[model samples]
Target: MIKWIIFDAMGVIFIVGDDTNDLLVPFIQGHNKRILKKTINEVYLRASLGQITSRQFWQEVGLGAQYPQIETVYLDTQLILDDGFTSVARMMSKQYSLALLSNDVSEWSAYLRNRFAMDFLDVFVISGDIHCRKPDLNIYKRFLKEAGTQAGECVFIDDRCKNLAVAKSMGFKTIYFVRQPKKSDFVPDASITSFNELENAIENICQQIIERVIFY
Candidate 1:
């Protein structure tokens, strides 16, 4: 039986998952159009890997003077908590363990969690803290370790196929969360376009798993 539900941070929990792509690059370019998007992304990669502090990320982007405000103005201002997610999370948390696995700057992730009152989730495995990112099985392994659960006992939800693929390969039941309807070839054990459908999808996956166990 699935006893845990793990969510991805940026896209799945927050409205934007790839914040570097959706938030940072544009913010940097807006300030200095001469700075190539590629360069901005390179610096963001370092920040997401914990190689640089959040302050250093702003400094690297030539916004050292604005570091204090950038996270609020550039990141938090643009990112939003997905509608209905919190309500569903409240209902589901009573039934199953909840976790968030994210590829994000450590400080930013923590701040966002606090800002959005997302500390309700039982566990958070951030890439910046661990110095690794998703689509890498290592991160998933770390999540399992931190959550104290077996892969088969967890349902991992994310907006990215690559991330889901890694989790599925590691014995997790994968749920593809379609937040903005991007094209994807990877199929998941289940899919949810909105949080309203989340509980049903999770229940269906659980029923299927139970049936499989009975049949086998």
Candidate 2:
């Protein structure tokens, strides 16, 4: 029986909703300014996965040009957690072995852990610490080793198609989270725009597995 549910942070747990693009659009549009450096998404990921320090990341992206004036905006823009994250996490803890598998840097993951106090999580794996990122099946294999569970017994949820495909290939039942439901998309084991929908997904997965086991 499926005994665990693994969640991806960032896109799956938090919703930024193109807010970064929202900020950059105005400046470039008004001035016809060329984007001079790495995209904010790249810089954010670099810092988030521990490839660079936050200061170095911000500076490289020209946030240092404005210095203290935009420090708050820069930091705030990168790490906005979605609403209802903690509540859903807490609720899921009651049912399955709730785990978070994130490709994040040391500092960013620390910030998120502090912000949410993820005491409810049974396994919190961060790629920065392990020096491995997902979509590389090794990371998923490592998680299986650490959790003492086989891939077939776990459900992996990620927003990235590449990552989800890897997990699915490794025998995990995969869920692709959509930011909003569309009229057409290959249905996942379940797709949820919000954390509130997670419990029902878990229950459905459990029922499906149970039926399969009975038939076998």
Candidate 3:
């Protein structure tokens, strides 16, 4: 049976999953017309990997002296919680341990969690804190270490299939989260278009696990 439920921060908990595409890219484009999206992406990745400080990220991205504004004007004002997720999570928390696995800047992750009041989470393995990002294998290892559970006992939910690919390889049961369903080549153990559907999908996975153990 799954004991821990690990959710990705961006898309899973927050409404915007791909912050580079949804939040950062547009912010950069609007603020600095000369910086290419490629530069923004690379610098962002460095920040997420803990290779650079949050202040340095802004400076490198041509937003020097703007980290304070960013916390207020950008992330604080823009990042939104997924509607109805907190309620569902409260109910689910009684049944399973909830944790977070995210690729985010260290300071940004903490601020976001505090802003949204994610007190329900017990473990948070953030890339910015650990110097490793998803799909690299080490990040997931860090999660398992921090969570004190094996991959099989955890259910990881993410909006990005590539991150899920690595988790699946590591023996994690994955649920793909999408705002809306579309034809996709990649498949996960379950899929949900909305947060309200999560409990049912998790229950279904648990049931399957029980049945498999019975059969064995």
Candidate 4:
């Protein structure tokens, strides 16, 4: 029986807009834009792993001098909540253990926790905090340990196929969040585009589990 519901933060729980570059480009646009972009991409993984501080990341990206301005611009550009997901999460928290597993930085994660009241969550396995990111088996195993649940006893939800694939392989029931279905070898147990659909999908999964237990 599934006792925990694990969610991915960025694309699933929060909308970081269509492109993150849209948020940062305005603050650091110049002839060195391409160079700065390359630098950011190179350091992003390291930064997310907490190998470097948030201040160091901004500095490496050439926005160190305008850190405050760039930070405001980035925050203003993205919507924190992904519409109905917050309500769904709140409702689900009452019945099952809730966890957040995300490839996130420390500063933004701290800001998010402060901006939103997510006290219902039983575990928050952030990449920066753990020094590991999803798609890495160790991270998923870490989540399982921290969440205090076996992989088979949790439902993992993510917008990325690669992340879901890893969870599915590790015995988690997977849910894929996408608007349009695409051809992929990695198939999710459930696919949902909107939060309304997600609620129904989870309900159906739980019902199936109950039915199986009763039948056996």
Which candidate number has the best TM-score? 1
Point out where model 1 deviates above 4 Å: 182-184
Q: How many collisions per candidate?
A: 3, 3, 1, 0
Residue-wise lDDT of candidate 1 within 1-216, one digit each (tens)? 889999887788777777777877887888877888898999888998999999998888888888788767865677878888899998899999999999999998888888878767999999999999988778998988888889999999999998998888889999998877777777899998888999999989999988998999
lDDT by residue for model 3 over 58-88, one digit each (tens)?
A: 8898888676786567876678888888998
Clashing pairs in 3: 11-17
Task: Estimate, for each residue in 1-216, the C-alpha lDDT of model 2 and write its tens digit.
Answer: 888889888677766434336543443233334544246667656665567775675576655666544544544555567777788778777778988888876666666676667888888888877767877777898899889999999998887767887888778988878775445433467777777787788788889988988999
List the candidates ranked by TM-score, beginning with the highest. 1, 3, 4, 2
Candidate 4 lDDT over 55-76, as tens digits, reads 8877877778877666656655
Find the number of clashing residue pairs for candidate 4: 0
The true-versus-predicted C-alpha distance at residue 200 of model 3, in Å, is: 0.7
Clashing pairs in 1: 10-16, 10-17, 11-17
Alpha-carbon local distance difference test for all models: 0.87, 0.72, 0.88, 0.79
Off by over 4 Å in 4: 16-34, 211-216
Q: After superposition, how far is residue 94 of candidate 1 from its true place, in Å?
A: 0.6
Stretches of model 3 off by over 4 angstroms after superposition: 180-184
Better of 2 and 4 by lDDT: 4
**Candidate 2 colliding pairs:** 48-105, 49-105, 50-105
